[model samples]
Target: MTETTIRKPIRKAVFPVAGLGTRFLPATKAIPKEMLPIIDRPLIQYAVDEAREAGIEQLIFVTGRGKTAIVEHFDTAFELEATMSSRGKDLSILAPTRIQPGNLVTVRQQVPMGLGHAIWCARAIVGNEPFAIFLPDELMIGSPGCMKQMVEAYNEVGGNLISVLEVPEEEVSSYGVIKPGAKVSGSLTEVVGLVEKPKREEAPSNLIISGRYILQPEVMRTLEGQEKGAGGEIQLTDAMAKMIGNQAFHAVTFAGRRYDCGSKSGFVEATLELALERSDMAADVRAAIKRLAATFD
Candidate 1:
């Protein structure tokens, strides 16, 4: 690892979960969207597990009102556990839900300003280290997790790193597109510049920013200006763009399937796909689906 990489070992990760999740309403009206289970595990659990696998010591959650369920999700359910144990039932089911003490930290974003503002709210807790950001709505299914791959590249590049996923050229305008400058490694590239939701013809490349990001502390300082962008709100991409050319900037092209869990369709698809991979539920899920398909036939 380079000297810079050693100094900023990336011990903290910020999860931007304050969004109102209007797309998934009215289920989200009372429960947080992150608390919605993909199958058995909630969406936030997958994100936290990924961060923990990447050596992230602190999971900093940027949340809002009605999001207490998110915080409680990671806490010890003492009464429930005690009841389960008293019945002589196996307790391994609650294993993954348990979070170690001191590993989780949460801060409230009073208002829904924007992604940048929500992240900026964590500046104090994050202090001066280069922290990571993970959007729980995007479930990245990979062997080592997306953030771990980015950390490997971040260690070598020693600057800001964002995960890039190849989308159809027609979908370029849906995400922040990157202008590939040079190849850094196998799937890593030197990102000289980027454009937010550019038209197909204006897109720098087919690559679009994914949900994972390893950013320097300076990005928060840049967001302090609170300059509103496309949606009349401070966009994180705009602030991140300013960091280009200031240091080493690159994008790590992902080698995993990303399930967009923010929308109903995507969430259902993820549930079905993941359910098919389990031993206990695979047969039943597939048989039920096949029966349902026969009805259409």
Candidate 2:
């Protein structure tokens, strides 16, 4: 067999966790939405863990007000660790969760402009490096994690690789839809064009862009112009669309389950599914679910 070489260009990752989770109301009033718990771990933790798994060396978080709790969550809590150690609790449980030293950096978004603006805020820190951007609100559950899969695809293609999934026609209006080009491989499609929040009939394709992306740094220049697109917000997709023919852009259909934790129904579903997957809560959770289902029956 010929040797198959994979090139990994993107090492740093930018996570935009500055969104005001007004949808969650009182719960998110004092807490950042990224800090909301999915099951035992916070939503942002899953995004961080995914980035680390993809061999990302540096983690850049673009945050805003009321997001200090997110910074503290990843930082070393010496007292808490010491207490857990003294209690003879399994430290390994916390090992995979903690952010490795010196690898994390946070930059303030300052303004709630948009996803594009949030990403642009990290331009100085990102410098000239091609990096990954992950939205923690889209909680992905799988053996290899969503972004890791995208990284694997990125190594093969060496250009912008986005995570995409097919949504129902009715749901096309809720996402940035792609105009797909020639097929490259299984679950990998060449991106011809991109449209943000297009109506069902106007959608170029059924494929919807998810939260994971391995983007080239030049896109930063596009956002630097700060031209507003949909909803009068700087749109990353609009910037990315400009890079289409100039660069190699493709979409990877991630092999995993994605939960939109930003929505009420999605959050509840993720919570219940994740809770049921936990050994500590699985049994009781299944029983509770069965009882609840019986009530509906």
Candidate 3:
């Protein structure tokens, strides 16, 4: 089949969890950064739930030496389940943690390379099928979830797709901005080119690449020879840029709230906002927030 051929469905997703999270040093020393919690569920759990909602059957994780906790999080805990069952406690909460046999796969990224290198590590399992990619630290909150929205769009246009959201002009340099082409639809744009962390004056558009992606397997082939780009590491943006005209490349504008849980402020905001939405904690959280605000005043 050719590069643009519609052969297999997008049945798999890759989560790059091998990063040494130096930003959250002390906390992430022992725990994988993806295991950091937002409310009751870990950040990786949120990404997995989003992937499942999008009908993704296989979950592929690119891990590192100290990231075994991530694999354990999705495995069935017999002792914990039995304890809860015998104590007459609710077992429904543990349902999301269980994965069926062979549905989950983990590959180690031996070195701490760029995001492109990390994704390339999972090339074997992804095979020739189109797959989704989720940066677990990005906590996306939406009605149907971010990946579901991308999958719905991917169904209509079956090629490489990336999620984009408009950032302020000054903040454009902090992200990979797209050189947009013709407007495909309401929230879809034809991506003609991609620039990684361009200066504000040189930016093509304020629309920055977000964390969720549904990429064609051809991307893996391009990454095989991908040289270091902006960060002196194998940059995914550079590889994606090369595939712009070869395939049907497009960007889905995510209509949702995205918390960059990789950052401290963003993580705190996500915790408060999600907690405030919960019925069990809303009243207390709001009251505590009011008291905190008074203290600041």
Candidate 4:
């Protein structure tokens, strides 16, 4: 008789792109905010790229009404690609948008629910294994990428791991602050509890939860019974907080840069910053920046 061990290779990642991006206003009225491009690529593309680099095989999208653009973006543009190839255009640029038909999946949320609700809606597809959740609005650009870093940390910790970052104490109230426990060396912090948007003085720690998360299937069950929190919506933090002691919950301070693409100012800044890094756009972007700065000076 041969003994078998369960292999917990993180494979599936869920993207909650269903929310009404009201912050972006008229623009988001038609196109999903996830489709908003940072430079040449869309916000969701950066997130998808990060997930794929972390060895995630299936991309599960939790979409809402009027978000068909997201579905079309991931699907093949056979006619467009064929035309591009015939016109001597490079087809390799379209590689990131290509997800094998079998590898991509989407489930409609059907409502403007909370993040927990959005994640819970995908329960049928997530099954009984550990999975990941990414908020496309939070764009993290780095060498190893945010999710890749979390996936590597997850392989060692084997439980719920959220990518966190340090923010000014005053800004802690705007985020789900982590109630940190024992220092587990390096960037790993044992998560003793969670506080969803606590007052500045009431916050446990300055380390706030960013978008990237590696969660267990049990969370779906927890979310099933979760009530409304901060904004009267089923909060994912509430469900995650419940699993703290029962599961190995920890936080990894992401080694990268994160941009809040959900906001107009942050969106503009990210576009300019990322564009300035590209060789083809750097010179023009820099020149434009100087011209804009001269107006201020």
lDDT of 3 by residue, 109-218 (tens): 99877999999999999998999999988899997899999998888888889999998999998998999997668889999999878999999999999999999999
TM-scores for all predictions: 0.96, 0.94, 0.97, 0.96
Better of 2 and 3 by lDDT: 3
**Candidate 1 structure quality by residue, lDDT tens digits, 1-297:** 748636679899999899998998898999999999988899999999999889999999998989999999888999999999999999898887777898888999998889999999999999889999999999999987999999888877778999999999999988889999966679889998989889999999999888999999999889998589878888998898889989778999988899888778889999999999999999999999999999998
**Model 1 misplacement above 4 A:** 1-5
Q: Count of backbone clashes for each model? A: 0, 0, 0, 0
Which regions of candidate 3 are displaced past 4 Å? 1-7
Candidates in order: C-alpha RMSD to true structure = 1.5, 2.4, 1.9, 1.9
Error of 4 at 124 (Å): 0.9
Clash pairs, model 2 backbone: none
What is the model-wide C-alpha lDDT for candidate 1?
Answer: 0.90
* Comparison by lDDT, 1 against 3, better one: 3
Whole-model Cα lDDT of every candidate shown, in order: 0.90, 0.88, 0.92, 0.90
Evaluated at residue 163, the lDDT of candidate 3 is 96
Number of clashes in model 2?
0
